[model samples]
Target: MITLKNVNVNELESAAQSCDFILPIEQTAVWASYQATIEGRKPWGCFIIQQDEKPLAFISLIDFETHGYHYVRSMHGPAWLEHPTQELETQVLQALATQLKQADKNLVFMRVDTWYDNLAVPVLSTVPYNQTVIISLEGGYEEILKRMKTRGRRDVRKAMRECPATCMDETERAYNDFSEYYEVMVDTGKRDGFVPAPLSDYTDMLGALGKDHCRVFAARVDERVVGWSIITMHGPVAVRYYAAMRSDAMHMFVTDRLLYAECCMLYDLGVTHYDLMGIGNDFAPSLKGLNVFKTKFSTEIIPVAAGRDIPLRPVYYKALTTAKKLRKVLKH
Candidate 1:
């Protein structure tokens, strides 16, 4: 029988390390702590699932509320410790939904963010992009460069040689330098047609995650910041969660150099995988512009499982869905 047991962060982290499972940064304890810093979000719990006393998977969840409806979200989990089959995933989700509902009467649903592939279940809200580019950081810096596309390699070299931009780890000075990064982010969002998150969101994230798990890399020309990338690390994986560059500095290829330098730094820290986060695909065409930039760093695009919302209260969930649709229509 499959059972979900509550565990602490250290226990869960240790299990993942012992099993050699790559725990996503979003599912880490640090991420839960970061979520706690955000309003309307709370660290629910960390859990380990077992089948007949053998550990199967681990997940950390955060509780959130939307329009007065409470829900718990598991981001990039449950990370399986053993080889997972569809049957196992189905069983696990079913069991998790039931258990979570029993634990919190106010929770209307549970959102399971995908880390697996081809989940045969209905998803109310899908991930922004179900596919992403992952670069293996196993080999040395030169070997890592060899895996990049020709354009990527040339851009990095040219950015280093011709551009006066210098990239360095600025995590220690993240507070002092964050204003510059945020200014660039706001400009990038305006240029890209998206709204950037509030300043406190990024600041709280950096403060909560700290320097050990999060690093801020900045590319500067003449001592002025031109680009920035925020990387989050957990176990053997490092994810580039946020990146932005000044519109005026685009010609210098600062971002290209910044990411390459970040990858090298991660590799040196014993990180095995560098996730460039989401990329545009046929299903998520809105993000296609990201493909031109992110794909240059890696040769392969990885398809992962998408998120699913398992409703515990059917009537309430239906009402919530209708209200959400109405809001969208009203906005338009």
Candidate 2:
């Protein structure tokens, strides 16, 4: 029988370090703490899924509510320690949902971001794009540049020659410049037709992750900050979490230089892979521009598995789903 054994946050971190596959930042304990800082979210502790005392996977759950209906979510996880077939995944998820329901009668469903190309089980919603670009940082800075497309290489070189400087700041003092970065993000959202998260969200993320694992890189021209990016490190990999630039500075290609510098810095820090995050997939047509921009840095695109929601209370889950659809339609 499968059982969920609760563990402390430190235990979760230690387990993640020794896990077989790379765990997403969202699955980390630090991320759970960061989520707790956001309003209307709560950390439900970490757990180890075991069958007959043999450990299978570790997952950190976060509690969330939508339209007064509470649900549990595990983002980009149950970081499996060993490869499992689709049947195993389905069994584990079913056991997890059953265990979770027993623990919290209020939970209507369990949302999980599984690392599978497909699943036999039912899912409430399908992820449109599970693909992202990853750049290898193995062969040093010059080799890294050689791997990029011609346009990416040219832009980096040009920006390096023209920009005053590009640097990564991981010091505690760097938090002081967050307001300036938030301003750029606000402008970026307006220009891109998306809403920016509150400044506190970003600030809390940096704080929760701490300076050793997270940092900000900025590109400047004549002492003025033109572009900036936030990166988080885990084991041998680093992820580019967020980035924004002053719209007028697009011609300067500061973003290109900024990311190049960040790559060099991560390589120097012993990171083997740099994940540029999501890009356009067939389902997400709106991300085409993002695909064009991110793919310039690396030709390699990795496809990940989609997320699934296992509903325990079918009636409430159906009601919640219908309400969400109605809300989206009303907004449109």
- Model 1: residues >4 Å from true position, as ranges? 18-22, 115-127
lDDT of each: 0.82, 0.78
lDDT tens per residue, model 1, 1-332: 99998987767888877777767878777787889888999988888888997889889888997667788888777877655787788788878877887888999888775544433235556545689899988888998889999888888888778777888888888866578789989999998888999988889989999888888989988888889988888778888889988899988777778888888888988988998978777757777878988898788999866666778887888887788689889999
Candidate 2 residue runs with Cα over 4 Å from true position: 1-3, 16-22, 116-128, 162-165, 168-173
Question: Using lDDT as the measure, which candidate wins?
Answer: 1
Residues 243-273 of candidate 2 have per-residue lDDT tens digits of 9898888887677778899899889889999
- Clash pairs for candidate 1: none
Against the true structure, what is every candidate's RMSD? 2.3, 2.7
RMSD of 1: 2.3
Global lDDT of model 1: 0.82
The estimated TM-scores of all candidates read 0.92, 0.89
